[model samples]
Target: MISKKAIQIFSVGIIAPLTLQSCQQNAVTNSGDADTLTGRLVITGSSTVAPLVSEIGKQFEGENPNVRIDVQTGGSSRGISDVRNGIADIGMVSRGITPEDDDLSFHSIAQDGVGIIIHQDNPVDSLSDEQVKQIFTGEISNWQEVGGEDAPITVVNKAEGRSTLELFLDYFALSNSQIKPSVVIGDNQQGIKTVEGNLFAIGYVSIGTAEFSVSNNVPIKLLPLNGVMANGDNVANGSFPLSRPLNLVTNGEEDLLTQAFINYSQSAEVHDLIKKQDFVPLSR
Candidate 1:
């Protein structure tokens, strides 16, 4: 069933306070028709956060005709790198920024959880935390070992530089080297597609993304983590164990357009946009 819970969630581990109000007065007016805002903004990073941000960007553009927003996705690390290197005006990061990353400013727009996913036909409904760890580590190589059909488990892992991979490694007490992956995917959709195409494949992705895909009739199942159901409600309520903040990042004091766009993304105006993407939006 689709979750009825509001996806709005408070951002945890904020490195700095976000400036919500846009400084339109201080902004340099673009040379244009003189009535509409005009400028180009580039945002890049986390595939998980890209779609929601893109939707928000479209709305912002409609309100300000000449303003163009370009959204790109690689991984959270790429978002950090591009913003820090001044290539992108803003970056999308799916995980929280720690003190070690104090150089850049973080603006949290939403929250999400990472959950295990498998083919819909897989008979194994659940696995113990230890079993999940063992399976990824290659200690349990076959589905039969976990009460499923007798077939070798094809592990799907996220590629390096993706926050999902880092969070999964941390939660499972593992290093990337410990995993025996049959395939390495770049984003949530890719991971979902990988598992959907292979009945014995197991993977992980944003619970919000998984929920959205499942609602769209995607042939994949989000396995329960431990005993908790993996759904948007659990993620919004903080019951899900592996939730992370979805953030927009800026390296330093941003230009007027960048600041305005970031402010709009975090504002209550975009809550529905976040909800449509199945991510928890920032609370009032």
Candidate 2:
């Protein structure tokens, strides 16, 4: 039997919004009082980072009692845009900020790796980076070419605006226009489900997301990249080649509430929350 504490962790920590893709909407609510550390926090960005951020907000709200955090996700692009355009308090981005994003401050809250996933029964256990690149770019369309069955490969790709998609393309040095996909998904779970349901399908997603699904008996397997497995242990140890920072971006000048939340997100208390979401916490 699971204790209430463990169950609570599973509720907000592992599940909650971890598998959700948010609408193009902003939410606002107030908690506590203005006299205290109370304010409305509008968080918008990457669906991958939204779940962890949401969990942190839940714990922070429990402790502070005066802060309300409104978490929303469209993609990593939206998170960056929301911060730049002054529409949100903090933007949840799963990739490192490039030179183009010079206006906001980058605060890394966790680390995660992108994993190439296939159906569990696919028999193919791994893929070389070159093979992955070719498969996604439409150069290799048959599973047999990569030591799998004779079925034609069905590519499951992420939608535009997703940081996961951007990091994947950047790591492989491919452009969006160069790739052809049979299906496009918005979040990690969608991609997982698509691949799980189709034996011939293949997709890349957050390793944390994939691991969580696998733990729950999801019919998917993560294919190693360049002979390295996509797991949090490897990612945390810096052995995983496809790891990316899960960041929270704020304006160079931020408010008191925003600052507190950022600090709380990086606190030791939130480390379990990060792990529960299948992400690696910063070394304590």
Give the Cα lDDT of each candidate.
0.82, 0.82
Task: List candidate 1 stretches off by more than 4 Å.
Answer: 1-36
Residue range 3-76, candidate 2, lDDT tens digits: 22211112332233432223223233344554467655778778888889887888887886755677777778
The TM-score of predicted model 2 comes to 0.87
Output the lDDT of residue 18, model 1. Answer: 26
My TM-score estimates for the predictions, one after another, are 0.87, 0.87
Model 1 error, position 228 (Å): 0.9
The alpha-carbon deviation from the true structure for residue 150 of candidate 1, after best TM-score superposition, in angstroms, is: 0.9
Q: Write the per-residue lDDT of candidate 1 for residues 127-183, one digit (tens) a residue.
A: 888999999999999999999999999999998888999999989899999999999
